[model samples]
Target: MRKLLAATLGILSAVGGFVDVGDLVAASQAGARFGMAHSWVLLLGVVAICAYAEMAGRIAAVTGRAVFDLIRERLGARVALLNLVASYVVTVVTLAAELGGVALAVRLATGVPYLIWVPVAGAAVWLVLWRMRFPVMERVFGLAGLALVVFAVALFWLPTDWAALGHSAVSGGQAGQGWGAYWFVAVALFASTVSPYEVFFFSSGGVEERWGTADLADARFSVLVGFPIGGFLALALIATATVVLRPAGLTVTGLEQVAHPVVLAFGGLGLAIAALAFFAVTFGAALETGLSAAYAAAQYFGWQWGKRVSPREATRFHTVLLVSVLLGVLLLLTAIDPVALTEYMLIISAVALPLTYLPILVVANDRTYLGDRVNGPWLNTLAAALLLVILAASIVAIPLAIGTRMGQ
Candidate 1:
């Protein structure tokens, strides 16, 4: 039972990452316009994330250290700090999007304006981080996030043309949308699927729980099970959107629009499940991005972090946490639509993918860190190929965004 519980924590963390606000919008947008052709992006992303996250978990279990800590040691403090600044900024922007997602979910549930729920959501997120037992928080949000399976269920409930969806997944083309727009959605969906903070939080959580070599098997199992399930759920989001929203030619502008497809299939009850699913995933992920932002800062600087210690003991870490969340709140106060900020963050995420991933690939082979446990030949080959694809995506994200006006 204890093992099952621990595995659930890892899966929950992955699930939390898989269906956050950015993904909820991005996946739906991709599906509504491009159909299931972007499904491969999620598959690619899940593979890449699983590969590196396992490396990270191995490092944590073997060394009792987090990825960012090794980043500074390997990449030098100056470079890691610079990476820290960029990663921290991007992560906080993500947090703001998630906070906005939570607020939007609340509004959908209660009919209150999302703006009115923003501060309430922020405060509630902060309170949980400050006061909740870490494990309890993980379980509550993780289990609730499973409610998102309704999206997959809704796929069956609706009049889905299964063979058509399968054909789209297999045929893999832009259809009516230009290839530029198609790939743009692909990049955004991939970025959202394997966003950097998920790795930072996952490996750090392993370290926090003091995972050892014995725990490594459990860790790998969780990633294998959790991430693919998460990816499957994301695909269902797209499939649901393709079925309901694409016919209407609706563009996704918020969580509400993302939920519209489900609402069409299931009515108000579907709306309720979708709202709760969004809220739980975003709420859970807000915790991750918030912690991950701080974790990177602390690990880079070699300051102690994790909820096992008091805030005073990890003052620098807690300060970074407080500051990151505040920055997210301030960003929203500027009155930027939260959904739009998510789009920008996804682009920025595309740019930074190599920065975050290169370090993992490098460290995974460090004999000093892993000894004989370093990546074998096949894994390295796969990792290198994926790395090239990520760099290509990073290089092209801006050009495509400009050429297409962010996929107009």
Candidate 2:
């Protein structure tokens, strides 16, 4: 039972990276604009994240180190510092976007202005990080995030054309949207799926929990089970949008639009459930991204970090966490659109994907780290192939975004 509960880290990481505010916008935009044309992209992303996360979990369990720790060792301090700079920027921006999402969700539920909730959400997230047990924090939000299954439930309740949805999934047609726009959404959704912070949080969580060789099986189980469940929820979001929003020509510019299909299916109750799910996933992601920003900074500097220590003992780590959340709230206070911020966050995440992933692939195969536990032939092949895809996305992300004018 304890092992099962430990899976919440994976669940939280998956939910935060795969289905957070970014995915909520990107996935629904894909479904609304291009039907199921990007379904294959989501599937590919899930496979990539699972493969990389498995290796990350294994590395942490065996070496008692997280990805950034290995990165500094393998890449040298100068190069790893550069990597940390880029990663920290991306992660802080992601944290800002997630805080915006939490505020937007609050606005959806209470009809209050989202800006009013920004500081409230930030303070709450920081408080939880300060006082809560790590596993307990992850489990609470991860389990509550399952409220998103309401999307899948609403699909069955609505008059979904299962056959057409399946056909579109296989067909990969762009539904009159240009190829540029289609690929734009694909890259955005793909970036959300394999966001760098997910791996950072996953491995950091393993280290924080003191995973060892004995915990390897439990970590693997969590990555395998938890991430795919996140992918399923993301797919349900796509399917719901395809059924309810595509025909209406809606483009999902806000959380409200993302919830429309469910609203259509069950009215007020569905809206309430969708709002709860939105808040849980976004708030959970805010926690993950806040920790990830701090993790990268601490790991790169070789400072002692983790929730296992008291705040005074890990003052620097806790300071970074507090600052990251504050930065997020401040960013939202500028009154930027949370949904738009998420779009920009996905684009930046796409460009920075390889920096975070390449180190994992290299270290996962290094016998120095894992000894006999190194990635085997099949995992290596998958990791290598996924690396190629990630590189393609990175190379093309900016060009696609510019060419499509942010997917028009």
Model 1 residue 103 CA deviation (Å) reads 1.0
lDDT of 1 by residue, 22-89 (tens): 78989999988888888889889889888888888898999888988988888897898889888888
lDDT of 2 by residue, 129-233 (tens): 999886766766777788899999999999888999999999967667788888899999999899999999999988887899998887788788788899999
lDDT (0-100) at residue 408 of candidate 1? Answer: 74
Deviating ranges (above 4 Å) for candidate 1: none
For each candidate, the alpha-carbon lDDT, in order, equals 0.87, 0.90
Best by lDDT: 2
Where model 2 places Cα greater than 4 Å from the true spot, the runs are 1-17
lDDT, model 2, position 127: 93
Q: TM-score for model 1?
A: 0.97
